[model samples]
Target: MTARTFQATNPATGQPLAPAFPVTTPQEMEALVAAARGAARAFAASTPTQRADFLNAAAAAIEARADAFVEAAMAEAGLPEPRLRGEVGRTANQLRLFAGVAADGSWVDARIDHADPARKPPKPDVRSLRVPLGPVAVFGASNFPLAFSVAGGDTASALAAGCPVVVKAHPAHPATSKLAAEAIRAAAQQCGLPAGVFGIVYEDGHELGVQLVQHPDIHAVGFTGSRAGGLALVAAAQAREVPIPVYAEMSSVNPSVFTAAALEANGAALAKGLAASISGSGGQLCTQPGLLFVPVGEAGDAFLNDVAAKLDATPACTLLTGGILNAFQKGAAGHLKAAGVQPLTQGAKPDSGAQPQLLSVPIAQFTPELADEVFGPLSVAVRYDRLEEVTPLLAGLEGQLTATLHATDAELDGLADLLHVMGTRAGRLVLNGFPTGVEVGHAMVHGGPFPATSDGGASTSVGSRAITRFARLRAYQDFPDRALPPELQEANPYGIWRLVDGERTR
Candidate 1:
């Protein structure tokens, strides 16, 4: 029988794009997993410098064909040219960032301890360093076709950690995912790496992804999407005979609190900034502030009026997919029906697209449903009587990727308890700023506790630290210096930082 195929739709035009992509069958998926397993040893044995070279090459290849990627993403994702172009750049930069991490040699967290013959119980020499976790299965995200999809942060970090990667191309942007996979494959070939070092499978449904996660040879999984999707993958991975780790970044409302002092000081400015953050990219961002806490007074009323005005001026845009727009509409409708919830203002509503929406509700009537993310240009402002109300409300929120606070310097000291609560509820805290923009760097934390990420915020899906997720520590006890890896050898041939006898040294 012939295999099934699917076409990506142009969300802007409500039409499917040409060049249907063949869906991967169970047989093909098995072969891909087998190939990745076959190449795992050789890929893991490769030197960090070799992996770094491959990563850099991948970045260069992607940049060389960036326009093709941008164009495809624009049509498939219904994103503007500038946003798509920026995403391509961000994807390339992520690869290069991991390249630097791969070359550094310090990320492995090498540690060594010398033998002590004089002790009552003789201590044997022990050296330890991180090693690859073999093959990894990556699920591309629908929203971030580039930055979090194929050849994105997860792929880069896994490759840098010396693991073979098999990407399940997102159905939303198959063409873009295909382009990225090709670039990475070319990089692997150029670096003399095995053919199975990287692979991509096209599929639209959950069966293939569940199969990939359940494969015995696949040691880890990386995912980015909705809460339901992440939890589904997590459950599948857990059900396997020998379960593997699933680093899935899921939902986050990214609540922002506005103190009375801050609202009084810059009500208009805050409103403008908050409106833009909510409306940007049609509010598809994971860190978009979905919930806001504002003082219940003239200042807050003025701020809300300004925000409504700004949102009214914003234009409606095509969402990444029709289903997403439908979900947005449903979620918004549900919010409007909730007790004490009233529509403040909304953007222009087109025949087929998403419009910005602002809703208001009293703090007393705030329910759990109010905090749920709508995944579009929609947010809720909860009016509070005093600053003290925010602490309990923030504490009640689920684990979030970010929690922001807008307060004056003078009020910060008094709001220390609230800030502390925010820290516990979120992975990243922003002061006097919105949470839509996530920086990619050593300090950036893209994962959060619970529903925000599957790992309970223990791991990050961005920045240099992300590589550690694809690795496991191995200890060489009483092994000869010659038999040990270069990073853990007595000679320290890698010349990287290592912990020696509980002391950090070079």
Candidate 2:
């Protein structure tokens, strides 16, 4: 009933799942953001207990209706029941994590630096605390509808940090977004919070998203999508007069390096694992292992052959949307025909739109340009002749969300230097495990540098780190005890984490 109610169409069947709603007009978008801004002002000023209560209520509400949420998301996105169900659990867990974090209030990290009055010279005291950064614009991703859409990590973390959200629903899953938005709105109302604490905008085109990010009132932007799309929004935000920080997770070729020793030890088993990873989620995850670097030898060749054959045999499922399917086909074909690239596995040309394939080339042939992600169920195998030949090429790898090193104890010990360098190059370093299973926990850093994300060491899309994006620091200089804010008061009413004179204490 908002100005826009975008329709969701099935990618495989080409049928309308729901009626389309009008795109939000510029004025309507502004009004929605204004409401969120007002809500943010009050929400940020609320006690940590109140904020935590609201977040817990929202999580409980979502969990209670988990089945309906999963079904709606599956209907719109074409994901199978199992994946959707797990993603729904992830979504609720994220909300619950943020709830615990907000209640604890330790993320703010209040600090107080006292003056050296005892010394010959008198110095001024300094006290600081973190404050919410007004309203945020969140652009949902197509791949993980529940975990990245309306009731996703972006909204959860922003709310935990006491910032309001305006979610630009992904066109691929509008119905699911709408349903999730309703649940969040209901929770806000139940908590007696202001209306429009979280706003949902339904728009199929990019124009509205551009407007939302460029809006002067929007303090920051959170996005997860393709490199092209995420970059456009980042550019728009930077172009603003008062530039806002755009935390965008663009692209990553989560390259998996298989040591010669590991291949020699268990080539066949490793090949099967690689096949499953490349084909999982139709190879749609940002952390999907797209590239496999294997040492050139009889065992390596045999392993790659097995992987290629298995990929060809696997049946392709429907992609998230028609646009994604088209892009996948175009990118797969282009990458396959590129210089030095060779087809490893080409899925059977099915009667429907199921295009799943794998391609490979030699290390010398795989250039930095070829390392670019194709965004589908496509994998590239790079054959290395020697360990020395692998290092230089590995060093040239761009910053990635994750880089996996497949090795045994002997192989890992031999590749210690490589592991050390890889830790710096990627936000996450996986050892002998598929990179697809991203666990939501405190230690997880689901973002990376450069094209993987705009900010280095800051997670834009996943885990508790996402909450940091919604806050700014505030200092209280020489104020009366009564005038000091409750969060930064000497009495410690909130009883959260704090740093007193350069020391962390409860």
The candidate that achieves the highest lDDT relative to the unseen native structure:
1
- Model 2 TM: 0.95
Q: Please, what are the lDDT tens digits per residue for candidate 2 over residues 195-291?
A: 8689988888899899899888899998889989988998999899999998888898888888778888888888888888887888888988877
How many steric clashes does model 1 contain? 0
Q: lDDT (CA) for every model shown?
A: 0.90, 0.82
- Candidate 2 lDDT at 287 equals 89
Judge candidate 1 at residue 165 and give its lDDT: 96
Instruction: Please tell me which predicted candidate would have the highest TM-score against the true structure.
Output: 1
**Which pairs of residues have clashing backbones in candidate 1?**
none
Number of backbone collisions per candidate: 0, 1
Instruction: Report residue 452 deviation for candidate 1 (angstroms).
Output: 0.4
- Model 2, residue pairs in steric clash: 5-21
- Per residue, candidate 1 scores C-alpha lDDT tens digits across 1-506 of 97899999999888989889999988988888889999999888888799899999999999998999989999899899888888888888999999899898899999999989898899999999999999999999988999999989999999999999999999999999899988998998899998899988899888898888888999999999998999999999999999999999999999999988898999888998999999999899999999999889999999998998998888886788988999898888888889998888854222324778889999999999899988989889999998898899889989999999999999877888998999999999999988987888999998888889999999999888999999999999998888989998878887899999999999
TM-scores vs. true structure, each candidate: 0.98, 0.95
